[model samples]
Target: MISRVTQQTVQKSTLANLQLNLSRMSDLQGRLSGGKLITKPSDDPGGTASALQLRASQRAAEQVARNVDNGIGWLGTVDSALQTSLDSLRRARDLTVQGANGSMSAQARDAIAVEIEGIRSAMLSEANTSFLGRSVFAGTSNTGVAFAPDYTHQGAPGSSVERRISSDATVRVDVDGSAVYGQGPWDPVTATGSVFGLLDQIAADLRAGLPISDHIAHLDTRRDSMLGELGAVGSRYGRLETVQQGVQKTIMDLKGQVSAIEDIDLAETMVELQSQEVAYQAALGATARVLQPSLLDFLR
Candidate 1:
C-alpha cells in the first residue's frame, strides 16, 4: 500500500489534471455557443484557411454585383437621354412640317427656329450624360467626359467595359459609346455636329426667305436615322436587364455556397454541445467522489 504522503501527492496530481480538462471543456463550450469552429490559429489551421478563402470569394462576388448595379444605372441614364432626344426630334420634325406650308410668315418660322435651338442644346447636354463622376459613354477614358462641350465624342473606337462576375465568367458592363453615338449606322451626326446644327441651318434658311420643303424632307431622313439608333440602344438595355437577372441568380447561388462553407449546422452543434455538457457533469460527479477522501480516513 502507498504511504499517506504518496497518496496525498497522487490526489493533488489528479486534481491538477482534472482542473486542466475542465478549462478546456469551458473553452469548447464558449466556442460551441458562439457557433464558430475555431477562435484562434492554434485551434484549427486548416479550417481557418478554408474559411478565409470562402470569405474572399464572397467579397469578390459582392463587388461584381455592385459593378452590375453601376452598369444598370448607366444604362438607365442613357435610355432616358435617348428618349428625350427622340421626343425633341419628333417635335422638331412636326414644326418643320408646319413651317413648310408656305403660308406661314417669316416671323412664325423664326419662332419655330428658336424652339429647335433649345432642342439642339438639350441634345448636346444629353450626349454629355454622367454617372458617379464618370461619363457613361466615354469609352475607356474614365476621367474624360463622354461628349465634348461642343457635342463631339472621344474615346477608343469600340472600347468595351467588362466585369468579372465569377472566377470563370466575365460580362460586358457597358456598350461602346462610339458604337452607340459616334459612328457606324448612325454616322450622319458628325462627332462635331450637334443635332442642333441641322435644326439651326433649317431655321436660318426659313428665316432668310428660302423655300424650305426639300430641306425639311432631308431633315426627316436624319430624324428617322436617329430614331433607329435609339431603338438599337433600347435593345441593348433590354439585354442588360436579362444579364442582370442572371447575375442575381448567380449571387443567390454564391451566397448559398458561402453559407454552406462558413455557417455551422445549428441542430448538430446544439446536440453535440448538450451531450458534451452532460458528459462533463457526469465526469465532475465521478471526480468529486474520487477526490473527496480525507487524510484522516487514510490514517484510520
Candidate 2:
C-alpha cells in the first residue's frame, strides 16, 4: 500500500516549524534587552533558584554591614568624650598641686579654689556627654544625660548597647557610666568614692587655706581610673575597625555571587542573539520555498 501525502500536512508542518523559530528569536531578543539570563523561572529553573538564594544572602550581609557602621559611630562618640574627660582631669591635677603650696596666701588659695570649681563644672559637662541625643556612657539608659547636675550616674551597671555585625559577632557600643564617673557624692567613711565629690573637698580645703597636699593623692587615683576607661574605649574602637573591614569584605563577596548567578555577559549574549537571528531568517526562507504553490499543485 502507498501512503498519500496531502498539501494540508505539508502546510501544517511548515507553520509549526516557523512558529518555533519565531519563539526562539523572541526569547533571545528579550534576553538581550533585559541583560539577564533568567528573566523568569521557566528560563532556567536551577539558575533562578540559585540567584534567589544568593540575593537573600547579599541582603543579609548588607544589613550586617550597616550594623557595623552604626556601632562604629557610637564607639567613636564614646572615644571622643573619654579623651576630653582625661584632658580636663590632667588640668585639674596641675591646679591642685599649685593650691597645695604652703607659700600661697589665703587670697591666692581662694583664687585657686574658684578655678578648681570651674574645672569641676567643666568635668560635669563631660560626664553628661550625649551623642545623637543619647548618652553614650549611659549603658542603654533613656536618661537625657549620663550624669545629673550633681554628678550622680544615670546609667545602670553592666548594661550595654550593642549591635550585631555578623552571624557570630556582636559589638558593644555603650560604656558603663558609673565605672567612668563613679556613684557621685563622696562618702566620708570611704575616701575617693566620687571624682566630683573629691574635687569639691579639694576646693573647700583650698578656700580655707587648709593644706591640700593630702588631696593630691586622691586626685592621682581618680586620674588613673579615667585613664583605664580611656584604654577600654580605645580597645573597642580598634575592634570596631577590624569588624568593619570584615563586614565590607563579606558584602562584596555576596554581591559577586549574586552577579555570577543572575547577571548576563553582554558580549556572549550579543553573539548568541545574532546567531539566533540568522537561524530564524534561514528557517523563514526555507519554509517560504517549501510552501509556495507550483503550476501542477494549483491544478490539483
Candidate 3:
C-alpha cells in the first residue's frame, strides 16, 4: 500500500522541529549567561540530583568550619585563662617559699601575706574568666561568673561543651572549673585543700608567724595541678587547630566538588551556544522552505 504524504503532516513536522531547535538554542544561551550547566531538574535529572547533593554537602562542610572556628576561639580563651592562673599560682608558690624562711621578719611575712592575698584574688578572677559572656571553665552553666566572690563555684559540674567540626567528629571546648579550683569553699577537707582555701591558709599562717612547711607543700601540689590543667588546655587547643585545618581542607574540597557538578565551563558553554545558534538558524530556514511548499500544495 502506498501512503499519501499530506501538507498538514509536513506543516506540523516543520513547526515541531523548529520549536525543538529554538528550545535548544534558548537552553544553551541560558547556560552561557547563568554559568550553570543545570539550572533546572529537567535540564539533566541525574546531574541536578548530584549537584543538589554536592550543594548540601558544601553547606554542611561550611557549617562545620564555622563550628571549628568557634571551638578554636573558646579553647583559646580557656588556654589564656589557664596560663594566667598558672602564673598566679607560680607567684604564690614563690612567696610561700620565701615565707618559709625563718630569717624573714614578721613585717616581711606580713608583706608576703599581702602579696599572697593579691595573688589569690587574681587567681579567683582567672577562675571566673568568661568567653563570649559565658564561663569558659564552667561547662554549660549559664551563670555570668564561674566562681562567686566568696569562693563558691557557681558553674555546673561534670558537664562538657563540645563542637562538631565535621560529619563524624566532635571536640570538647570547655574545661571543668571545679577540677581546677576545687568545689570552691564547699570542697571537702583534703591534704592539699581547695585552691582558694590553700591560699587563705598560707596567708593566715604567714600572718600568725606559724610554720608554713605543710602550706608550702600544698602550694606546690596546687601548682602541679594548675600545670597539669595548662598541659591539658594546650593539648585541646592543638587538637582544635588540627581539626580546623582538616575542616578547612574539607570545605575547599566540597566547594570544588560542587563547582564541578553545578558550574559550567565557559569555553565549552560558549562553543555549544554558538553551535546551537547555527542549528537554530538552519532549522528556521528549513522550516520556511518546508512550510512554503506545504502552503502551495494546500492552495492547489
Number of the top-ranking candidate, with TM-score as the measure: 2
Query: Residue 206 of model 2: what lDDT?
Result: 87
Per-residue C-alpha lDDT of model 2 across residues 68-166, encoded as one tens digit per residue: 788888888887877887887788889899987889888998888888888888877877778778888788788888888777788876788988877
Two-way lDDT contest, 1 vs 3, winner: 3
Once fitted onto the true fold, the runs of candidate 1 whose alpha carbons sit more than 4 angstroms away are 1-24, 40-50, 141-150, 154-192
| Model 1: per-residue Cα lDDT over 80-137, one tens digit each | 8767767877788788788787888878988987887787677667666776676666
Write down the lDDT of every candidate, Cα atoms only: 0.66, 0.81, 0.82
By TM-score rank, best first, the candidates go: 2, 3, 1
Per residue, candidate 3 scores C-alpha lDDT tens digits across 1-300 of 988888788889889988998888888888888988888888789888887887888788788878878888988888888888888888898889899998899999999999998988888888888888999878899988887777777777568899987668788888888778775442225553368877887888899999887676676776777678778878877887887788788878888887887889999888888898898899889888877764468689
Which parts of model 3 have CA positions greater than 4 angstroms off?
1-9, 166-169, 185-192, 288-300
lDDT at 24 for candidate 2?
Answer: 82
Shift of residue 28 alpha carbon in model 2, Å: 2.0
